[model samples]
Target: MKPSLLILIHLNDASRASIEAAFDVVYAPDSTRRSAAIAARGDTIRAVLTNGTTGLTAAEIDRMPQLELISALGAGYENLAVDHARSRGIVLVNGAGTNDHCVADHAFALLLAIVRDVPQLDRATRDGIWRDTLPMQPNVSGKRLGIVGLGNIGEKVARRGAGFDMDIAYHNRKPREGSALRYFDSVVALARWSDFLVVATPGGAGTHHLIGKPVFEALGPNGFVVNVSRGSVLDTAALAQALVTQTIAGAALDVYESEPHPPEALLTLRNVVLTPHVGGRSPEAITASVDNFLANATRHFAGKAVLTPI
Candidate 1:
């Protein structure tokens, strides 16, 4: 018999069909349903499928004492209870590179939108305010772009920046040895040199609030910032203050610290553009993520090391 699995995220028709075909699937009704369902069939569940933000708790894992593996449907597994799962001898995996391009695309999209003042322009056009009434926005071409954490998504963002003839410089935990791209040893240094700063780092204790007052201050009054990475990477309160005081020119973000709900301060700002944490989401990206999940799960049960271990 196929191993029983619990799916937490909302899936489309195609995803649901694929998951059901491979596992004895169970649906989590909601957060409440999760505890109830786990309690009822704790010993029966062999695996749990979830996303980074909608993580499976240690308590949830405890309820299913028989669980051998946990899977993150996307790249970000920030909220996953990794220590507990690791202690229990359960393999944890994420779909890291599966959605890199999608997220990279979104990062540039946000960058362009905010820098070019697309939203304000659209609103102005709708309100019958002609282009002449608006101040001219800067051109994206031939600008300096500084990227934080040049991993898979960061590299993709750099590639896109190259297409725009923008000079690319990056800062990571360590210099990406032997790489040809210009390297900045600090976030403040990177922000100082960049006309646009794009953040694509992984989030955890190590990166929490990596971009804060100092970085924003370095960005100065003419620089723009875009965060396609996690929200905690930037200080939301400081960012809001920066926008309000014009410390930075403008900002765009696809993720926020409050998650499903954005910070109350950001809603009142016109200099910032926000999205509901959908940087790596697309039909293609979602489908690829599920495929990675299935592949990792299958390999784990088959006694092989999983791909993209978190």
Candidate 2:
């Protein structure tokens, strides 16, 4: 019999089928079902699949005494109990590069959607409003673009910015090796220097609420902010206040403090654009991520070193 594998995130039929071929999957995409699966099949489960957002907890890990590997289908593992898992000798891996391009594509999409006022313009056009009544929006070209993280997705966002002839700079804990993009040691400083700010940083305690009132203030009244990273990185209360006061020109977000539910405070605001967290989601991205997971899991079960261990 195949090794029992517990899955804590939702997967489409094809993806599930692919994994089912390799392991006995307990599909539990919700808390109730997850707990039930853990209680029922904890003894037999030897591997688990989850994403950054739907992390497996230390307690859950403890329940799965047989679990030897935990795989995140996407690049992020922010919510995963990394130290705890490491202490238990559980092998951990994430699909780091699998969805970078899709996320980068969505980041630019959000940036342009808000910068060009696409959604509002579409509404106005449908309501018989004309160009004479709309406020003039600035060009995306010839602007300084600031990235909050200089990782793979951030680099891709910068490359897209370059296509529009925008100057690109980034902020990380430290400057990335061999990167020529201007680096700021602080997020507030980067925001002040940028015409557009795009956040793609990691989530978790280190980055939670990193983009709050101070960073918003630095962006100034004419600047725009875009976030395609984790929602926890941006504070909803601060963002709502900033939008109401016009502290920043406008903002676009693919992810925000609230997930699964829309941010209530931002709902009534016209200057902000929001998307459900679909930044790193695409058919191509999903396939690549699952394929990466399967390869890593296969290597581990075969007693070889897994690729892309976190």
Candidate 3:
């Protein structure tokens, strides 16, 4: 018999079909259904498919006594109860590198959208306004780009910035060994020195509101900020205030603190651009992430080492 797998996130038909071939899936993408599934089939469930945001709790893990593996479909696993799962001897795996390119691409898309005033300009043009009447936006080339985290995604963002002739610098917990880009000891310092600040840090308590009023102030009135990482990394209230007061030139975000719904504070602002948290989403990315999960789960069940153990 196929192992029972509890799915805790939405999946496209293609992904569902492929996964269905290998396991008996309980397609519970919400709270009520998830709880019911665990209650009804807990003993038979041997695996779980979830993302970082839609995490499997210690209590939930406890309910699934038969669960031997848990897999996060994407790179971010900020909310996952990793330690507890490890304690239960359940193998944990994530698709860390699967969506790096997609995220980097989305980050640049946000940066360019804000820096070039693409959305506003498009609207103005539609309104029959000419360049002569509209305010001039700054060039994206030859700018100083500051990246908050220099991980795999950040490095890819740097590579994209380089193509635009940008002078790239980054702030990490410590200097990344053998990295050629300038390293900043602090996020504020990096923001102060940059024409654009792109946040790519991880989520969780350690980085919650890491980009706040101080960092926004340091970026000055002409600088722009882009967040392609987790929403908790930036203070949405502070960002909205910055836009209202023109504390910064403009801002763009792929994620915000109040997610699944547009931030009420920045909804009416003309200087801000927002996209649903889709930085790591693409057909290619989805396929790669699904394949990564299948590989890890298959190996674990086959009595082999999981490929991307968390």
Candidate 2, residue 49: how far the Cα is off, in Å: 0.5
lDDT of 2 by residue, 1-310 (tens): 8989999998999999999999999999999999999999998899999999988889989998998999999999998988999999999999999999999999998888899999999999999999998999999999999999999999999999999999999999999999999999999999999999999999999999999999999999999999998999999999999999999988999987768899999999999999999999999999999999999999999999999999
Which ranges in model 2 have alpha carbons more than 4 Å from their true place?
A: none
Per-residue lDDT tens digits for candidate 3, residues 198-282, read: 9998888899999999999999999999999899999999999999999999999999888788899998999999999999999
**Which residue ranges in model 3 land beyond 4 Å of their true spot?**
none
Per-candidate TM-score against the hidden true structure: 0.97, 0.99, 0.98
Per-residue lDDT tens digits for candidate 1, residues 1-310, read 9999988888888998998998998888478877777878778999999988888888888888789999999888888899999999999999989999999999999999999999999999999999888999999999999999899999999999999999999999889976789999999999999999999999878999999999999999999999988988999999999999999999999988998788788898888899888898899999999999999999998999999898
TM-score of candidate 2 to 2 decimals: 0.99
Instruction: Give candidate 2's error at residue 251 in angstroms.
Output: 1.1
Every candidate's lDDT: 0.91, 0.94, 0.94
What lDDT would candidate 3 get against the real structure?
0.94
Who is ahead in lDDT, 1 or 3? 3
- Candidate 2 — what's its lDDT? 0.94
